[model samples]
Target: MKRTLFAAIAMAAIAATSNAVLADTPSHRDAVAFVDQAKIGQNLPVIALSIAKQTVTFTTIASKLGNAGAVKAVSDEINALLPLYQPKWNENIAQAYEKSFTEEELSSLASEGRSSKYASKVLAQQGVIGKQMESTSKPILTDLVTQALRTVMSKTP
Candidate 1:
């Protein structure tokens, strides 16, 4: 009991310190959670953002923007699929991010350059958009798998 309490305190302190450095980058929070869950399982945490190297044809419309705008762009893309999957997404968040993000109460304004299946549909096109989707999906898929692994760990007997 003592050891578990100490470990929890340590995790909370480390998380608070880490969040200070990442106070502005909301996307980085997901990556950090991926890394944390990886650490708990003694796995490597260097998947890297696969989307960082890909090129895209779309221009962000924000007049004066920075990294925050870039984060907003990604959020917008995710929001576009909500109408088609928002019900499922709500359930997923209720199960997944229930204590963290207020997804059900908040409507997003971010719009993407394309849809969720953009990569599969345009794989042969060689358009910047196709590459863009591939780039984005890889790390997102990696994190998704990592979260699944975390769930498995949580249920271990």
Candidate 2:
């Protein structure tokens, strides 16, 4: 039993170390840098707000509540939560970049921004990339709106 437990602990440690190493791989780091260089996270709040506003459930709830104050409250809550959401969104975009481009391409993009030789390839794959981003972001957006609604409702009469 002691030997089995020791082996289990050793396996867990190796898994944890491998995850840390993978996260700092050249491609992953370059992807993150490229995301920053492209200013991808700068408009996240705006996009989140847009997504929230477009959500039918959110609008229906606000209309049923029949209070501009509630709408504003939800908006305010979303704004407050955006800072926490930004890093997650940036990481998702970075993962997308890592999947779509090689380490060298990511490094060049990070250094050169949109003027990199890979820019045209990126543009050509815009639809695919957009779908990938949207697929990942949909759940996060849903959660954001749900959280905002909950906050507003909890404060409501």
Candidate 3:
């Protein structure tokens, strides 16, 4: 219960700040640019997954772990933070840039905790349940991003 309360407040504060940062009349590309500026590493795939219109929905896992409130709160927080990550969408573009990657680049970006510093910062307070939620969410985020990208980037759907 205490964790839930703390997580909720923390997420709410983050949401508020992210929105405040963007409140100065931002553009879509401004958001996209944010995502695009990220360096390739552990964060690339996660950013790719995110830009493909994918998401992390840990609500069920949260509930099972007695943190449903925290889950919802965090989910909402991500929605709010989406704009901030908009520019780092290269991972999504990497499909086209496959030729640019050697085997090592691909391997490097996908390793466990590849983006440990950033990932840790983002996941700083996540408990066992939250980590479980992240592990479980990857596939779902991948599928959703693939579908959305197909629809948006292709001439014929």
Candidate 4:
């Protein structure tokens, strides 16, 4: 009885957390717009295909694992998984774009991205912006990781 009650409570907690996460997720349409503004779709297909190709190798050991005379197992598995992976890749890209940009930024970006001059200017400054972030964040992240590792190590011995 106690175990069953605990399991029910745990499930309720997980469901509540899931609902909260879903509620916080940005609009999918806004995410799609953000992806378009960022030109993420232009290279998404090529990147997804490349990643899928590599992923095929990971699950191709069915023959070696003795899965009952599996000659075309690898090929069959790859074919089956490709369709599943493509949509996930697109969804992940959309989610990333949504999480990274606010609705106002996405709206402005959609309009500005259509302008060649604006895009060119933004593209030119992109590298500088990345460098600025790297400079500002590297030290902070390094310190955080170092401290975390030291804590773990100290706790161990």
Residues 48-138, candidate 3: write the lDDT tens digits.
3334322332333343434544334444444444454422223222221222223344333334233533333333433432333233334
lDDT-based ranking, best first?
Answer: 2, 4, 3, 1
lDDT of 2 by residue, 40-150 (tens): 656555555555666675676677666475467777888888877667667766776676688899889988888899988766654545556665655566677778767
- Who wins the lDDT comparison? 2
Residue 103 in model 4: lDDT: 61
Model 4 lDDT tens row, 1-157: 3332222222222222222223244354655555455654333223222333343322343224433322233334434444544343334444443444556554555556655333453444333333332333333223333333333334332
When summed lDDT is taken over every stretch of 10 residues in candidate 1, the lowest stretch is 104-113
lDDT of each: 0.29, 0.64, 0.34, 0.37
* All candidates: CA RMSD (Å): 22.1, 12.5, 16.0, 17.4
Give model 1's clash tally.
2
**What total of clashing residue pairs does each candidate reach?**
2, 0, 12, 0
Candidate 3 at 77: error in angstroms?
20
Q: Residue by residue across 1-157, what tens digits does model 1's lDDT show? A: 3333222223222332222333234443443333233232111111111222122311222223444553354344434433443332222222222123232211110112133233232233223322322332333334433443333334333
**TM-scores for all candidates?**
0.21, 0.71, 0.23, 0.35
Maximum-TM-score candidate: 2
